[model samples]
Target: MYVTTSGRIHNFGAGPATLPLQVVEECQNALPNLNESGFGLMEISHRSETFQEIIDSAMGRLRRILTIPDEYTVLFLQGGASLQFYMSALNLLRPGDHVDFLVTGAWSQKAMKEANRIGDASPRWDDSENGFKSIPKNGEYSIRNDAMYVHYTSNNTLFGTQYHHLPDSDGKPRVLDASSDIAGVPIDVSAHDLIYAGAQKNLGPSGVTIVILSPWAMKRVGDDLPTMLDYSVHSSKGSLFNTPNTFGIFVLDRVLNWVEENGGLEGSVARNIAKSNLLYEELDRSSFWKPHAKKDSRSVMNVTWRLPNEKLEEKFLQEATIAGLGGLKGHRSVGGIRASLYNGCSIKSVEALVIFMRNFEQANH
Candidate 1:
């Protein structure tokens, strides 16, 4: 159940999750000198033929896996998903235009705050009262027909909650900050108008953000926004309108290729479900531990749980760390423990974690 090869259990931290060992090794060998070019990827010119190949291949592979339509363009840019809030608002909504925001967790709240910073509308949602314990369970979902665009965090990384299914908000363009869950599975791109993610979580490393958007969104860049701040213009001009994070894009290409080689999106999706099942089933079978996330709202990638109280939670986290399952500390807002089992963490790692949890329960409870 342990990664005896490296003598460490699989890591479950939320963002910047573990990547394939093969991919890591490949990078280690190539990084000292990239592709016989006598320089590391970081040292290469993004506009040079070598780096352009890496970036283009990344875009192609990502398109193939996601089945992105021709009408959409993929841009690898900087500033993380946070900056998308500004770009999205600027591109689509005017100063007084309303944007319907979904407040699901800390991430979504942050999105709203950022949205407000860029525009005047406030987040209108029912998820705040219970601290996002559960996604609103209403049988009906109504869209504010006049909103510029509907923004939602598809997966709440901090609280281990997810929209089990995409909401049916008719006729409105939907924007999702999929920073934590990008490349975890296949998505129906047709359903969304725009989607953005920080590459560090599951793509490769920090310093870049992947944005996949439809051509329809281009028309929505209603104002002649700032040169750098406009997505529609950026996409029209290609991502190379300015200097890019060359190495980040290269590493992203390597990781996306790794995902494809190991059975593509369908394969990754299967692995994620298997990994989640292994951990969730064990938690379900135990009385000593309970899941903090609601059953229906549970996050497949970020699983969170709590001990009896603060004292127990403290002991559990420390003990869990000593047991070699690192990055289990919960976000301050949630204050329990979070295990972000991203694509990189192997199945063996999760199995080891399950074993450790069972042992901890037997001894303490």
Candidate 2:
């Protein structure tokens, strides 16, 4: 395992999660005077040419990494993916229009509730009763003929479940909340009409949400929509419709630069797979570790599991934190353990975690 000279421990928090050290360092350097423009990063004006170049670089790098279509519009908006839940529905739906959801976890549940405010949003497939341990196969759900679009979360951060295939949307437009696994996994940008992700997890930091809109989605925006919630408005202004998250965008751009330098999207996917595989292998090695998600639906980013009991789980968390590993606690909604192996999480960190798990299991058992 690679030990940090700066004495930073491994972080496994779900969001506002770990970031690449190089990116963090770059941000640190820019804090004083970004690009020697004499304006501190946090103090840089959104309308300034220097900041314009930063946003452009970030967007351009994101497009290249994801291979987003030329016609697709990308916006770096605030309010995170939570806002997109309502905004997406508000822009895409009118009264009486139907929308279908594949509710895999809490976030999707919240999304469905928000969408209901706009139209007849209902879950076509919901795995909540089964403890959100698996993703539904295509045939398990049915889409309504009148459905305007089919929405699904690509990865459930809390439950450690992820979809490994493109969902069957019955030829309807597909809207996705890829918040937890945007550039970290394999995604066909052309397949979905709209995709939104919170940059904190796999991209950079909180306060910025990336939204991609297909031409179809843009044209479908309801007339007289709220100016800020309207996609076309942001698209017209190049995501500068408001003040924007200048600091977050700058960090995100640095993170993307790190991705490009290390190996683009393919590299990120491989690294995440390798990290998750190491941890999952340890979880599978002993009965002491009970993984939350089913094998077929396991997440490559966040790995969730449990110990023999709450006492053991608590003991594990405490000891792990003392051992220089942190943020392994599970979501309060489903208490256990969760280690998020995002793009920024190093393989060395996973290796260190696996070693800790092995020692803890043996000692506790």
Candidate 3:
């Protein structure tokens, strides 16, 4: 039952988010033999022409979908978004150069900790103080103009906070982790110096991180950096530095193509708005439940909520599993309920989950 989509199950896993039904069907055909090449997409050679086409198509569609300026180049590389945190820090920052990070939740906390260990860094506005419920609007922290980069996790998957309004840091290069929110909606990429997203949630799958960096940021990698850790080498080699994730790139291409056919970013954004709005509205209307993230900065991708108590949260998870909404439990660091509604999560899925929420509320209350 879990294997099939039509049995009224809705997957709410934050990473490894749901892929479109059409993509699954395409996978069925492409799995056996990709475009009659007699090799499945997973089995295709990464250096082969077929896989190159897949990579090119995916990168091109990513630019189109993200409205990435021609100034930035899209690179598909191995490693999740966490790898990107380290790489972004290492490539953009010199040993003693100052950097700014906005600590919002678990992902950024990891990013900050990792960046702190590597180079000079500072944080601007962080609201982990209020239990990660809100994004800092303005704060006393002074940003250095010559800062390497200002980093922020646009959407906090763990704590359900989002920066609906981005920070205004004059003349500073900015880096954003749009990992869980990529392609679910449109963004102003021009505002940031660089952007990185893991394909798992809204893009495609694990093992691939997509980056669009400014030409300036790309050149900052000095020869002293390790060859494997350098973006310049990866970009010069067309993300073919070492072996690329051929299968992940292939699926991402298909997913982005699906986004194009289904009305591109605007269509996905509208659908995502509807899906997340439904789930959040359910949480708002139910007396037995409450949203964890603040109202002004609620995430449209990951919605975290909780019952009155931990025991009730456990009970909700058990009942929700029985009801076929998989991976609805929150991250262990902030345990409760987290309904991840990414690009491919259908409105029908949200509707069924809302029904489950109503049932859970009734039973628990």
Model 3, runs deviating above 4 Å: 1-8, 138-141
TM-score of 1: 0.95
Candidate 3 CA-lDDT value? 0.83
Measured on C-alpha atoms, candidate 2 has an lDDT of: 0.94
Worst 10 residues of 2 by lDDT: 1-10
Q: Which rank order by lDDT, best down to worst?
A: 2, 3, 1
| After superposition, candidate 1 runs with Cα above 4 Å error | 1-3, 7-9, 118-122, 137-139
In model 2, the clashing pairs are none
lDDT of each: 0.80, 0.94, 0.83
Query: For model 2, how does the per-residue alpha-carbon lDDT over 281-303 read when each residue is reduced to its tens digit?
Result: 99999999999999999999999
lDDT string for model 3 (1-365, tens) is 34334654678888887898888778778987997889997888888888888888888898888888997878888778888888888888767778888888888888887787678777677676788897767544567777778888888888888877767665688789999887876689888878898999997878888988888777776777888888888888999988888878888988999999999999999998898888878878866887888798898988998789999998888887777778898988778899898988888888888987887778779
The superposed Cα distance between candidate 3 and the true structure at residue 249, in angstroms, equals 0.5
Residue range 87-150, candidate 1, lDDT tens digits = 7777777677778777788777777777775666556575777878776544444666687777
